[model samples]
Target: MKKIIVVAGLLLTMGFHASAEGYQVNLQSTKQAGMAHVGAALKLGAESMHFNPAGLSFMKENISLSAGASAVFTDLEYSKDGYKHNSDNPIGTPFYLYAGFKIYDNLAAGVSVNTPYGSSIDWGVNWAGSRLVQDITLKSFSIQPTISYRPFEKLSLGAGLMFMYGNFSLSRVLIPAGDLESLRPFAAAVPSLGQTLDNFKDIDAASATLSGDAGVKVGFNIGAMYDITDKITVGVSYRSKVKMRVPEGHAEMNYANETELKQMIATVNPLLIAYKKNPIVIPPLDKGTFSAELPLPSNLNVAVSYQATDRLLLSGEVQFVGWSAYKALNVQFSQEVLNGYSINAPKNYENTRIYRLGGQFAATERLDLRLGAYLDESPVPGEFLNPETPSMNKMGLSTGLSFRPLERLSVDLAFTYVTGFGRDGSYPYVSNDQVKAFGGHYDVKALNPSFGISYAF
Candidate 1:
């Protein structure tokens, strides 16, 4: 039971990493996303609240509103030892809404609601790696109220209070049907147990489902934007790390061969009693609960925008992700059978960087065109990679356009394509008190289409 409980925690911890690396959603603004999600140095009115709040104070409108959503279609494949598996992931929808108003000559205020981190990966119920992770879905959002102040005509500063909430549900195999062969030796020593175990040769494996809701956590986003010249601007921003805690979570167990399992336990008790060994006990699923803590890493961005001509603008940015803060995860279960057991798993993630470049051209009075590209690095080491979150370095290409149907209203559309550099990695852990490992070649790719509308007056 102890070994079973520990493997459960091991799988849960691996599932949490799905929110980082290539899985972080970056579809806040359709107009910005057209440019590979680079906008820290641009004056984007209400949309600036997400890229860089400092740009809000430079808005030309008294009121601004922007809302948009994207559909993420992802594909993942894994191959190992002549076995191939593909993820049947559902389409992920990430959206954003921002509203800002000019409070005074040099002051601006706004609020933003967005889904910034999420992922859905399903490798089916009986994949080759089902023991590690069969499926996982993570959802999270943040609401921020921001304030921007332009103390000087050429300089602006801003800050926002971030309230974040998240939740996840995952399922994994606890004991595979094939692993039951280990009991063959014990069964041979006890004829009654052997007879009972023979009836379970074709039974389904044991599995578990874990679900949890994290409490609201607080963080901050701060930024500065400066006009270096009439045609050039520079900006920097920092988003603080948020620590999310699950006070109480639920865990449910499913045993396909319950009857046969109980019979074997009953039959083997006498042999254990003669050897003075403790009797085996199974915990009740209805009363099982757990607690865990996870972290959303910090972000640092530096960007610059250049206006080359009256109708053309170019922007570039560098983003540093502080994934190193995610050093470990601790999970505790409230089950009498566990004997106060806890699992502390180490996740030695490394910091990573993203480089972005984008260009926007005003083709006509009512139309604008944009194109962008970015490179995102993977934070996970090769040896630590797992199927739950098979991460690798990726490249993104994007294009978008904005059409003004009315003087104060604009319709935006953007498309982004992501391709990962295929990778091969492995993860090792203890299963049934024995050291084991899982490894394979992985490939990932995705397409995102975004639609949005912005109004200002």
Candidate 2:
């Protein structure tokens, strides 16, 4: 049998999903989450900083503040030939805070601190596909200071500077086979198999596991809204791409499985020694740090709102993700020998469009009810849905309510259930540079619950 050895290059996919639009936590405001994030054109005040900062110009209060968080629960199931393996709950909590104040009759300023982009995926300690990934954690936050101006009676424009920070970490088993018995045949096939196998036979006793992180990134956002009629408004917004660089990262190893490595080396030593060739020399791992770069994508959104009646409001929005920019993963390690090596993964992610429809009703003088639904198209081409991120297209149902116990204070709550579309992606060797993931069928689902409070003065 031909020995197929994997590369020891640095991982590039680490930064691929951090700021993904599909992965961005929408819990910054329960009000928006409940309405399927529909308020771009009609929204006003602090929370508008996320969907469209320009909406802040319509605030009815002199000052407003809101805080909230979302609890995300997700599940992914993998199946091969009818058998299945389930992923652990990749639970993530994203927090949001926003403050807005009227600077003048037609101008406003606001600040928002939130976790807009992030994810956590854990496949656990041992699995049928340990090489794929064991765990993934991406923590990101953005502090945006924004200003909105209503230069015209029915129009508003806004811009903000996004001070973004995202930290990425990943862990996976590098080499699954640690036993000498399993290494023998793979070793015996080396001379015919080439350097990959010859190098595998000389695998470092300590290099069986891998892990690392990407330090930080920065970006920005711009938006505007226009009133077409007394009861109609249109909105547009753009968020710039974040550029990230990890100058140095650490990868640790456990030597508990060194026994098999030693035996493999000891058994191969005699033949080479007796044959007059130099005995096998096990290479030294002797390094811990590496460096890499991964850039997230950008996005544009257009939304509209209509006042259908005195007690009802209607909304629809379309968001365009620039995923086509994400074409490949590139990483450069720090070690001298590894300096020439890189782990590159191809993610031919295509641009995606998300559609949302929602409605809001004033149930009473102090109460409002909101309901909505949306379809999110996955940018990840099935061929690219690897163990690290099995991203898929989904449809979600959401409902929420806001109750004003006092004239100045209101509490908001929302619930969202997203159902994912599953598929079976088979890996067929396409190109020399194209690396494929373990072939399998995947099923996924998510539940999001959010709570928040807003106060105006």
Candidate 3:
């Protein structure tokens, strides 16, 4: 049963990728809680290592450590013509860890392990759209070690080396049997219908293959922060994109009968069967590479904080993400095995900009509370929204609290609500220019809540 489930999961992953909107995963960390408080580290503690490594320059402690986790919920639905289907993904948990220290009077260094990208979708096998894409699983994790220097009392510079690892699995079903009859007329037109039939049979037996891959990559980030005054600050950073390659992978096909397929080939023109075997068996076996050139989108952040009677702080920021550079998923394979299977993603995707505003209040000498909101634009077009990575414009609302039971120990907890623009699209089963079947639009949605703890030594 487990093997069957695994195979089914693999098949679902393939179908989803065939229709995915972007090759990138959407696993942004909850570290944004600290980002909400512009002075979180410049005047507070170590969470700055993630919000802006440059903020580490303001750390006064010899050592600081922080860890946290979040529970995410996603709901999706689809509609087309007069039919509709929906899927609600179970709550998922993602985590993060960060450690930093003041190395010298003007310098600081830190390290972090966080899940920057990942998501999973599982639609029931009986759903009408399941044949198109039943499930999708993708994970992107990174370890970044950084250094920061305060050149002046009001300015800081930072840089980090990043090591990233990722994995992807997608699946769907391809009905080659249903397509054979549609090609009968074309096959009959060829003179040798028997030979043509043999070729078609081989293709059908090999048409659908379960595919998956895994890989590793590395990159870097550089940033700067400037304190314009006691109440305002700004930051700029660039993350270099990294490329990952899947060295070896596996592919499988759902065959009704291995014995019958062999017998049919022996009785028919075996040469034609052998010639067509390459397209079916060997083609899916090729070691294809999945390279993700995830350039760290350049970001510009300007933040302002005002002190209301030295107890409450209000802050807001505007950010821009250089997403336009993320234009395609360039796939490459060995020429000997995959002569015609390489594909380049379509080029309609564009970069996105985000706006964020929030405030924090120090209700007590030892307690801090925060609230924030942000609007994020969608990078995907309507035509590309699919079961895998179904992306849309997103809006978020968040609330968090920090407690200081001791002078050196602090605990922070946060909750966030993320919603996406509902979308519609279609998937068609086509091989050799003929459509055998089709599935209509579907919908999805998500929510996330998180918590963290920090200690200073």
Candidate 4:
């Protein structure tokens, strides 16, 4: 029975990495995203509150407000063992809002609301790999209140308080026929396992699902921006890691179908009877609660902005993600029979560096055009890659335009296309304490379009 508990989580992790940034989302600003997120040292209206709070000190107005939304279309394909399969096309919607004010001659304050991490994956209930994952969804959002101070001209410093909330859910199937290791230890008592081991085939015991909600988590960030020359500006920022946990949530477990299950039981019962051993008794799958915890990676960003001409601005940026701090995922369940039932998987994710370049051209006093590109690195090594996310090093192209139709109002629009190189990987199915292997390959692509409007008063 204990071994059965271990086999229950075979594919529980299949849905862990749907969002980019290794489950982190980077589309907080459509304008910045359109510029491949290269505006660390550039003035970006009120939206700058989220990217670099210190930028607020450069605002041209006493009060500013901005809002935007993004739509993402994604496709993921897999091929293995001469079989080609793909997950359902997943669509993600992310949005953000920002407000800033010049509180004093040298001080600025602002607030931001945004979806920082989120995405959903569906593998269809009857797909070849359905046994591993049916559906998985992750949603996360954050609120930040920031303040910036310019103690001296040309230099600004800022800080913010972060509050976050998230939700997670994962579903998969359980195999009844225990793998060799799971049954081997109990083989002495259940003589039938040894007698009919070769005759038994792995079949569904039940459909299992776990869902949890994150309690409020807190973290902080700080930034510095300085003007080196009349046309050059540099900025650096850091966001600390957030530790989050789902206190206690619900789990659903039950037989999805009964015809085949009854037949399998009938086949094994007589064998146990003849061996004078207790007949195999499948227990009812009970619904209960569970707990889980995960850590949000820390981030460091740096960039330099250059005014190449009177109407042209260029910027280059670098960002480092501390994914190595993510070591494992732990889940604990509540139930007498599953009293200590838990699942823990090692991630061993690595830190990654991202490069971005962008330029903005002022076509007219009220019209601006932006162009940018970026190369993003995946933190998961090939050997550790899993179906949960088909993440790979990616190259992205983006463009956007900002128009001021009214004296105090500006509207922004942006678009981006991102794709990954093919990646192949295999996952080990664990039974008892031993592992068996399976192989597969994955290819993924995404298209995102965004809209925004801002007002300066």
RMSD of 1: 2.9
The TM-score measured for candidate 3 stands at: 0.76
lDDT of 3 at 102: 90
TM values, all candidates: 0.92, 0.86, 0.76, 0.88
- CA lDDT, every model vs. true structure: 0.83, 0.71, 0.57, 0.76
Every model: Cα RMSD to truth: 2.9, 5.2, 7.1, 4.8
Per-residue lDDT of candidate 2, residues 18-117 (tens digit):
2124455556678988888776776658988888988988888899899998888888788997778887855688989999999898999999999877
Off by over 4 Å in 1: 1-7, 10-12, 17-23, 184-204, 264-286
Flag the better candidate by TM-score, 3 or 4.
4
Please rank every candidate by TM-score, starting with the best: 1, 4, 2, 3
lDDT for model 4, please: 0.76
Clashes of 2: 0
Locate the minimum summed-lDDT window of 10 residues in model 2.
1-10
Q: Least accurate stretch of 10 residues (summed lDDT) in model 3?
A: 1-10
Cα distance off (Å), candidate 1, residue 212: 1.2
Clashes of each: 0, 0, 25, 0
Give model 1's TM-score versus the native structure. 0.92
Model 1, 128: alpha-carbon shift in Å? 1.3
Model 3, span 1-457: residue lDDT tens:
0000011222211312111123332223343553432332233435565556787877888998888887767677766677666765555666778888898988999898876556667663435555456566666687899999999998888888878886655445443433333334434435554454555453333223333454567777777777777766666656665655555544554544555544543443343344442122223432443222333344444555555557666666655555566566544444455535545555346667666677777889889878877777766665555565466676777788888999887777777666665555544344443453453554444566677778888
Better of 2 and 3 by TM-score: 2
What is the RMSD of candidate 4?
4.8
* lDDT per residue (tens digit) for residues 1-457 in model 4: 3233225564245335543658777788867876887867987657777778888888879999999998888778878878987778568888999999998878999999998778777765545555567678888888999999999899998899989999987776554433323344445766655544444344444566667799999988788899999999999888889978989877676564455545545665565466554554443334466677888888899999999999999999998989888788777766766554567877788999989998889999898899999888998877667666667888888999989999788888998888887788876665434575556888888888999898999
lDDT head-to-head 2 vs 4, winner: 4
